[model samples]
Target: MNLDLLLEQVRSTSLLEWIAVTFGVSEVLLAKRNKVWLYPTGIISICCGAIVLIQAKLYAETILNAYYLGMSIYGWIKWKSRNQFGTPKITSSDSMDKVKTWGIVLIGWVVLYLFLINFTDSDVPIIDSLVSSTAWAGMWLLANRKVENWIWLNISNAIAIPLLFYKGLFMFGLLTVFLFVIAVLGYFDWRKILKEENNELQSV
Candidate 1:
């Protein structure tokens, strides 16, 4: 698409879409810095996102956005829970976290794909389900403060970009692209933080 046409579509976006995109950007930026505030911002973003996806006939993403609302709440609570030193420290995934993450991805894909094929008039069931399934795994891991969450989120964002544009959600497609960049930065930043924390513990 031409720059002029893209700019026009952006200007023509609804107020709700603007809100969703704004908060969505904030959510990812805060998440990249490992802030607990990301969850609340994400809650606001996904609530609006759910409506936007519904209008675009992206049933899987709409459901995933709704699931994000609950996960945001759960993540907020979990992030606030304090350990002996402070709020729960960020860390890399362990064996069990990896297992559960994979389970969410596989099971989420199967169930969402079947639901879309049988119940919804969705034309992009495969890619749509892949987007949501990876996102589900990411959100679950994020609640546990796992560094690997960014990896899964970036995977979802990568798959979701073209699909969002194909559905004429140009604004959201752009947001996903921004999210992709942030998730990439978040992955490396979180890993660095984890290493620093581990070093501090060893020294203590």
Candidate 2:
């Protein structure tokens, strides 16, 4: 199958939208396998997302996408390191102290909500915050290799799909729906990996 056909769907869409979706799918695939390279893929999507949302006149999403770009850079650096083979492997999972994990989650959601509410006048204020916050948490969890990130991704997709479709981004919205299904499978897959790793460590 000529995957090039996918580009046709993008033809009617802006370049940024196409770029964002392509890279977003790539990021999700890389993330499913716990690859550190997901960060760069995410960065590509984030940059394009910012542009696409801005062009579409969705200022709040535009800003969030910019923030995503910045976060991607940080995540990339944090994940890059040598694995058992001394090859560059992004962290599959890390021991995040419970206190720090909750702290970051709390602070991130609060800040994202407050910023959106105060800075934007969209009728779907809470919905916007919900998607952005969920995505931020998911991204952070993904950076740490937490299996829980897929849960957040699923939540974000639920909100994003309708929102994008309503906003006239049919292609982007459809993509989010596809992502949601993929994420569900990813959750189970990652959980299995984590369990196997834990069992191996216990045996060792």
Query: What's each prediction's clash count?
Result: 0, 0
Give the distance in Å from residue 14's predicted Cα in candidate 2 to where it truly belongs: 1.3
lDDT of each: 0.92, 0.73
Quantify how close model 2 is to the true structure by its C-alpha RMSD in Å: 4.8
Report how far off residue 3 is in candidate 2 (Å): 20
lDDT of 1 by residue, 1-204 (tens): 899997899888888899999999999999998899999888888988888888888999999998899899999998888878889888888998899999999999999999999999999999999999999999999998999999999899999999988988889999999999999999999999999999999999
Q: In model 1, which runs have C-alpha deviations exceeding 4 angstroms?
A: none
Q: What is the TM-score (0 to 1) of candidate 1?
A: 0.97
1-204, model 2: which lDDT tens digit per residue? 256755655567877787888888888888777777888888888887887776665665666677677777877776775567553332243455345545655676677667767876566666666777677777666666677778876887898888987787867887798799889988998888877877876899
Prediction RMSDs, each to the true structure: 0.9, 4.8
When summed lDDT is taken over every stretch of 10 residues in candidate 1, the lowest stretch is: 47-56
